[model samples]
Target: MRLLLLFFTVVLGADESFITPQEYAAQLYHNPRGIGCHLCHGEHGEGKVIAHYIDKGEKKAFEGPPIRALDFRRFDAALNRRNTGMPKYFLTAPERKALYRYLHPETVKDAHAEK
Candidate 1:
């Protein structure tokens, strides 16, 4: 089991050398390990209206809030907080930073795109 784990880790780490952080984050955000952020947040973290319904006999809209513009601290806090309307990902710090980079590529330092 340990040998298999080591082999997989080595293979994945090798692939990482060619892929940019943004690519990794894009895959995570779109496919996650489970529920996709894109389903709620849209392709660019711009957020989307999920559904329209009647509440208290009044029409209401359920929408995902915009995330791209949030500062890193606020973004991290939101991701870490429990009871978020979204599911808990329990993402690692680097993963969170990568997601932030995917959302705001212009603000981030150089993220080399894999050729």
Candidate 2:
């Protein structure tokens, strides 16, 4: 009986486990250049376009905006804006939270430094 209880507890505990925001951000950061966050945002999270398309009828190319990887330090302000062109990610609430946490510390550090 004790063994059965322990097994159940362990299984349930595993379900409750979650990644931290900082970890999520790191995952995003370390993601491959063309496959992960870098696919849209620039390599340094500086926001640059990775792709471009030419309109079928128009002679000029239509350039997309840089992928603005979440600037964690300015999160509050960014979230408040209505149209930032960033697509809503299909992440779970927890995953989103983790990503936010991970990006924020780095962004904060960047924002404060002399550039």
Candidate 3:
């Protein structure tokens, strides 16, 4: 009886370190490489106005566009390409997919299910 209890406890303890896909995606979204997407994009990727400035006294708002609504193709493409102010992280395919999943939870499916 004691051995059975010990075995179950060990199994449960091992399971604690294994994070779900959503949790992994959240980590990638928040801190991929050294820069966090949330710095410019909003906490949930809803976009944000990073700064306000006077460009030749014109008054300009430097903003991060909402990314939560972008489809996977567009999202992947944007990350791969160079934008005017956006940093080039050159993330891998899996990293990009994870980020997309984090933004669009509704579309998330079991990764293994696709195979």
Candidate 4:
């Protein structure tokens, strides 16, 4: 079992090292664990209305707020902390960073430079 786990880790790590930061981030944004962030957030994290319904004779929209404009701190906090209407992702620091990079491509260069 340990050998199998190590083999898989090495194989995955090899693939991970070859992909561009954007590509890695894109994958994570599209599907982290079993859920796709884009399903709630927009294609580019611009936010979207998930569903529309009537409450007490008033129409309301269930929406995922725009995450693209958020700073890394706030973005990370939101993903890590449990909140109403959002699932508990329990993502690691690196995963959260990747998701944030997907929303803000401009930071990609800075991220690379840091490494």
Candidate 5:
């Protein structure tokens, strides 16, 4: 059994494309470019509190917008344009689509599926 597996491995030549579409999407979501979407958006893109502090003798909070419910058009526009708070990312069309799909898994079941 070991010899057979080794033979297949050698024939396939050290394949690293074993990650599933969901796994790849997760990786891209977590480490696309330099920052992870989860840093601001919640793990499931449900939004999150980025920071809390005091200003003008009062308390304030900086929050990341929830994006799980966004439509593809809005999502694409948000990523492509120069937003006020968001860091501009030069992701490809497919990449942006992938991220959007990642943000909304239910509606996009197999829509952007790629290995």
Candidate 6:
């Protein structure tokens, strides 16, 4: 019985805890390597950037994707991308949960908010 209880505790303890949006944004901004969302998405998540190349005689800018940087505000939309250049992440279950927490933060207090 004790062993079973311990196993249950360990398993249940692994479940993700809730986090606010601000905290999530902070984590995204200050990743250990200093390469947070802003590194690619822009400081305000605005998806704006300076032009980097010229293609077909047209000046091409480095604008982020139309979807914008993993807009946690739109979790469903973000997850639907089939071939975004973003890394595969190779995240574990807990890490994925943490990412979800960051993206779909509970701070908005509006579970029904539109993207």
Q: Best-fitting candidate, measured by TM-score?
A: 4
TM-score of each: 0.78, 0.39, 0.79, 0.80, 0.78, 0.43
Per-residue accuracy of model 4 over 24-104 as CA lDDT, tens digit each: 789988889857989888899989899999999999999988889988889988987887777889788988988888888
What is the C-alpha lDDT profile of model 3 across 26-92, one tens digit per residue?
A: 9988889867999999999999999999998799999999999887899999998988888889788
Q: Write the per-residue lDDT of candidate 6 for residues 1-115, one digit (tens) a residue.
A: 9999999887777643344445544574446233455555555545546458989999877655533345454644343354354433333444434445544455346533422
In order, the Cα lDDT scores of the candidates are: 0.84, 0.50, 0.86, 0.85, 0.81, 0.50
What is the Cα-based lDDT of residue 11 in candidate 5? 68
Model 5's TM-score against the true structure: 0.78
TM-score of 6: 0.43
lDDT: worst 10-residue window of model 6: 87-96
lDDT of 5 by residue, 21-102 (tens): 6667788999989678899888999999999999999999888899999889998898889876678888998888778878
Encode model 1's per-residue lDDT on 1-115: one tens digit a residue: 9999999999999987787777888898888776888888888999999999999999998888878899999999988887457888878888888888789888656676422
Candidate 3: give its CA RMSD in angstroms.
4.5
> On a 0 to 100 scale, what is the lDDT of residue 102 in model 6?
48
Candidate 2 C-alpha lDDT tens digits along 1-115: 9999999999888754554444446675555222465445555455665445567765553233442454544543443354444544445445444445554464444432321
For residue 28, model 5's alpha carbon misses the true position, in angstroms, by 0.5
Quote the lDDT for 36 in model 2: 61
For every model shown, the clashing-pair count is 0, 3, 0, 0, 0, 0
Error of 4 at 24 (Å): 0.7
- Pairs of residues clashing in candidate 6: none
Q: What lDDT would candidate 6 get against the real structure?
A: 0.50
Query: Which 10 successive residues of model 5 have the least lDDT summed?
Result: 106-115
